[model samples]
Target chain A: MSDTKTKKKRKEKPPIEEPLLAPGHRACSGCGESLGAKLVMDAAGPNTYATCCTGCLEVFSTPYPESAWKMPWIHSLFENSSAVAAGIEAALIAQGRDKDVNIIAMGGDGGTADIGIGCLSGMLERGHNILYVCFDNEAYMNTGVQRSGLTPFDARTSTSPPGKRSWGNKTTKKNLPGIAGAHGIPYVATATVGYPNDLINKVKKALKIQGPKYMQVHVPCPLGWIHPTDQTIEIAKLAVLTGLIPIYEMEYGEVTRVRKIGKNRRPVEDYLKPQGRFRHLFAKGAEAEEELEKIRQIAEDNIKKFGLA
Target chain B: MARPRPAGYVAEPGSSKANKTGSWRTEKPVFLHDTCTDCRICVLVCPDGIIFGADSIYDADFDFCKGCGICAAECPVDDIEMAPEVR
Candidate 1:
């Protein structure tokens, strides 16, 4: 009788109202982009133009002539989605039809954090009214997970292969939100599919903003990630808990608010473990895990450095 | 007997994050000398090559720091923390 039996009730999040990106589409079982796109469509659909860069979303959603999208959709090259969206906005604005249409430029990490950045930056600087959402699955998933600027270091991708001498993805994931903030856009926010309500809230916010706005959604890919299909949300939740990815919002080139940090941020390993993507860390005679821990530490630093809490 | 749920705040539903702040992406790092052991862990751990100095002390080039805290972790003691809440 000495032990206090305490049963904490599960925080019953209200039932998610409706589905946006319907089923029967072909996406990898654990595709984070799919989940992210679902939230985007729910907030920006029925009267929006969705443009995707040539990547996994493009390949899967539009498998040559037979597309799964019922909405107005367009597929363009890797580095020009922004420019194309800009042109669409111009045409709409010129025709005095801007109030009715919403344009969203979607791409992977390679496109936004790398090739498509220049155009995306231009669109924001020009104050083009478009919602640019990047589903960051870390690397170029379609082109074989190469070490793109957004790919985190020490994580094994096809190109950033672990070898006897080199670590996986030597460089860090480029700060896309921070980079986008510099343009002095009307709005900017970061979200993850794990928190659908918050993610949807952000997309709604981005859509309501007058000038250009950006939303970087953390989408964990099972293909390049080496994680599981079921634990996609959990791993993502861990990312925020460990301060690896701080959910935040910025306005006019300034950070405004951040999500509260979970109480127990038990080292980086707590976030790194339980996934095959970080399996090498526990392997015998390898500092790969140690190196990853450093990354986790870096993520924690981001929280303190940014005052995410 | 009951367990306590942690106090965490969430953005109101259907609300917008349109508030403008004085600065964006400007997270300045402050060193807590009293808490610092001066182990120089930060000196070696800085991803950007900007945290070196004599006597194992460290300095961050905010322009170049990129706000990536290899230095904060490098500090053997918890000497480095984020600046106090401000614009």
Candidate 2:
């Protein structure tokens, strides 16, 4: 056989056989959340049941008479997806089908970091055999871009607009992975749409482990972040490369792996400049520079904390 | 095609495959077969799941592809390019 043919023969097969998440749903063009969700679903394979909270994913995937999900999927209230998934797990166990099926609970940052946190905590504490995936778009994008707990500092959302007395959202993004790790879950991972391979691998690995697993995926929103739709992956990549969002996995309350930034590590400005939500911090003056310094320091802190250097 | 009954009602699982979302695209991805490595990353990463084919060959179903260049971006070989739609 030729070299190319031999290489093809030696290549490992892709996990997904048929598309589990079908097309024709209403997700916006270049939606990082939808893309990341599909990657996760594909990696988890067909023998999975997903529970989605009332957010962009649920809205787009199930628009009456239409559903993108081919497998068993449930849409629950904004704050009860994890609880619903726990119920599903209980039922599966009752029927002795727990080993054959995987349970997944998914939600946006608004649902995961804020509204749904209480139920999420219960699900984690109960140690259900479920994987909870939070698509962190940083704001409540479905509801006119209101500020959510995951909204980063100095971001301009509808509820956190900049003014003379206010500098956008006056708080840092919540460390959800850290919170999940504190729950003593067997697996906790932070991923982004920028790295599909890493995201897929982590999802696959998480599914193999028993008990609760939490994954926080950074998904950029073009409408909320005010970036061109085409730059979705670019912005996501910059977010990780700049060390603003450290990609890592924790097992049993200890970080076991960190996706390094490598030689192409960039400054925080490179990640912040593309998104218009951070535009106010880029004005040609001293105040803007000061705020920029603070944001840069956050990235520096992440680098040091995760040992990304 | 009948109108949807109400908010709580659902048709069939994966019925969204009937909704053609191609018109939403302002740009479309064109696969460069020459530079393609057949890694299937585009097929794997496409949000719409419109890209198909196995091994070293692939094609897209433009009827549902919303032109989310996620495929183009994730293509390791830089084999997919996004082009502005003529319309």
Candidate 3:
């Protein structure tokens, strides 16, 4: 028997995969948001303290006292999670208790990118030792799927309801990575729920670093997106394949790495057709192709601008 | 009131984009003189139409560069690096 064989033989069944986020919470079936939360918690470990903003995640996952989180958790306002996390982090520093525990501030894209953009910016510039994670479902899911700062242009959210007059969200989604990078934070990364390993690895890496880190992850909302429960991962992967979303990393406001655009670039329709929000795109003379192309240009600009070919 | 960084070591851009309106470039690449064997890994990897010719053009076109650090990460010689994007 070789030494390598003995080491390989000792690797036992991967410990049965314990459920970090226990069942019985109010998340919908095959909820990518919950899956994202689970992945973050798993990477954050038991001693992590999470400060969540109000949204579908905070509302559904931790209703009242029945929180699915097994660790310390706090929920501030719908848009002030980042500020609260900063305050809590300050408290931790005052108590001389900065080691071992990880401080994570989480919220949906609506909370982080739209309503809380100011707070998020302030926190990043202050250089607080924390990890800010935005579970981007692309729109304001909790407020009946309204247009948000992260909402893709031309997506039929309730507020940006698609019609002959309006083309969903008229303005382009704000680039949070560019904004955060501008703050010169130590780390900033874009990830998605479709790649759990990459998401976990980035989280672990952020924990080891000394300064604040930002991770924006794409999560598909089956209920709000009007998507099939099972297509959560499928849709997420499609967003990356097409030019809808580009995954990359930024250090001190400079792009460090960019995941190459997949060779087989699926038509943007492939990503849009599956969701209900984009149903208007199929209407007569929709002209969604032209609008979707603009979205593609945005992704391309990031790729070219950041060299994420 | 904050004492700014000395001009030598580049710092990340300390700025915001919400107020920023145009197609302004972010991310700037710098040279790591020691590790850089002058290998054009950065020049080759740059998807943006920046970086100079192999005859040692030593050019980094900020206008088109967009500050994507493909050059920095792909630099096997570690000669290329990304400076903090200070506005």
Candidate 4:
């Protein structure tokens, strides 16, 4: 029995001897962003060069004296990671080594959706051979959980607190993938940390395609979202399962495939109730029910729009 | 012997294993090898990289395991159990 079990385990285990991103970085205990980034790195492999914007990933992975990256990595300014990646790609082409290496630029929602969108748009429009990855944790988590352009509707943040006059962030999450798709990139995909295999496969697929590519991965922030540290993966999965976040792939401004939620579709409440940022929606009385209805409608719209059902 | 080093760039990768982050846990996951199906899903999903062991004989290093229970949640066999830390 023991021998059989051992054999089965060995077969199931992944061959991960030398990870591109070495283990030993200063990320939070259950940070999905770091884990998701690690998955992306593992998929991209050693021959890839990555550029990061000033955010949690940049701060934790490449702290001045120490770095977790085993591959060539660069830390660019908050609004210029894509620009730096473009420059790197241009330099690689000048050396006639462009085809040999994969270029990746990564940033959080704050950097990607807000501050860095211009450079990102320029890189896409210019058709740079780089993959832009946005690890959307929904807010600016590194700077004490402030509201960003990607922060969901009615969600509480340090800047968008719920009080008498206001009811958290009044804005909806920006459609970053849509914006990237509008640039007519070669490939675009949306993934989350919950589905590691899918995320890895998407990264691998994106890397193989030439020209500009974009992948937006939903990384659940335990600190910012105010959920149990262990439930990071669970919460991320729930976001997709509830249709609040759609998983799909696009090519040249058109969606090529959609990862359907199918029969196990969950209600939006299942995703919102666990997060403290959305706790106000579940407060006393039916005052916030209207907001809850609006959120449900958003999910329904995503389900219909992406054909997730 | 002393030598002047070049400025910029980290020469060596920092090993976070030296920092025992287990104290931050309010709950801990206890692995039940008997019930474990040897799927190894937990090993792949663990963010801390503390869960170690090849095949059926799997174990977590309490010194570094922050008890995220990602292993438990990802376990296809439901072998790992999350118990509250006494201390």
**Which candidate tops DockQ?**
2
Of the candidates numbered 2 and 4, which has the greater lDDT value?
A: 2
Looking at candidate 2, what is the lDDT of residue B18? 85
Give the Cα-based TM-score of candidate 2 against the true structure.
0.92
* lDDT scores of the candidates, listed in order: 0.69, 0.88, 0.72, 0.87
C-alpha positional error of residue A208 in candidate 1 after TM-score superposition, expressed in Å: 0.8
Runs off by more than 4 Å, candidate 3: A1-10, B1-87
**What's model 1's lDDT at A210?**
86
Instruction: Quote model 1's iRMS.
Output: 20.7
**Strongest candidate by lDDT:** 2
Native RMSD of candidate 4 (Å):
2.8
- Docking verdict class for candidate 3: incorrect
- In model 4, what lDDT does residue A153 have? 91
Candidate 3 clashing pairs, residues 3+ apart or interchain: A306-B68, B11-B84, B12-B84, B12-B85, B13-B85, B13-B86, B27-B67, B36-B79, B42-B71
Q: Write the per-residue lDDT of candidate 2 for residues A1-309, one digit (tens) a residue.
A: 246654555566664454677788898988888888888898898899999999999999899878889888988699999999999999988998888688999999999999999999999999999999999999999888999999998999999999777779999999989999999999999999888889989999999999999999999999899998778888999999999899999999999999998788998998899899999888787888989999989999999999998
DockQ result, candidate 3: 0.01
Q: Could you give the C-alpha RMSD of every candidate to the true structure, in order shown? A: 19.5, 3.7, 19.2, 2.8
What are the runs in model 2 whose C-alpha is more than 4 Å off?
A1-18, B1-10, B73-78
How well does candidate 4 reproduce the true complex, by DockQ?
Answer: 0.40
> Per-residue lDDT for A12-34 in model 4, tens only?
55543535555556788788998
Better of 2 and 3 by TM-score: 2
* Cα lDDT for residue A260, candidate 2: 91
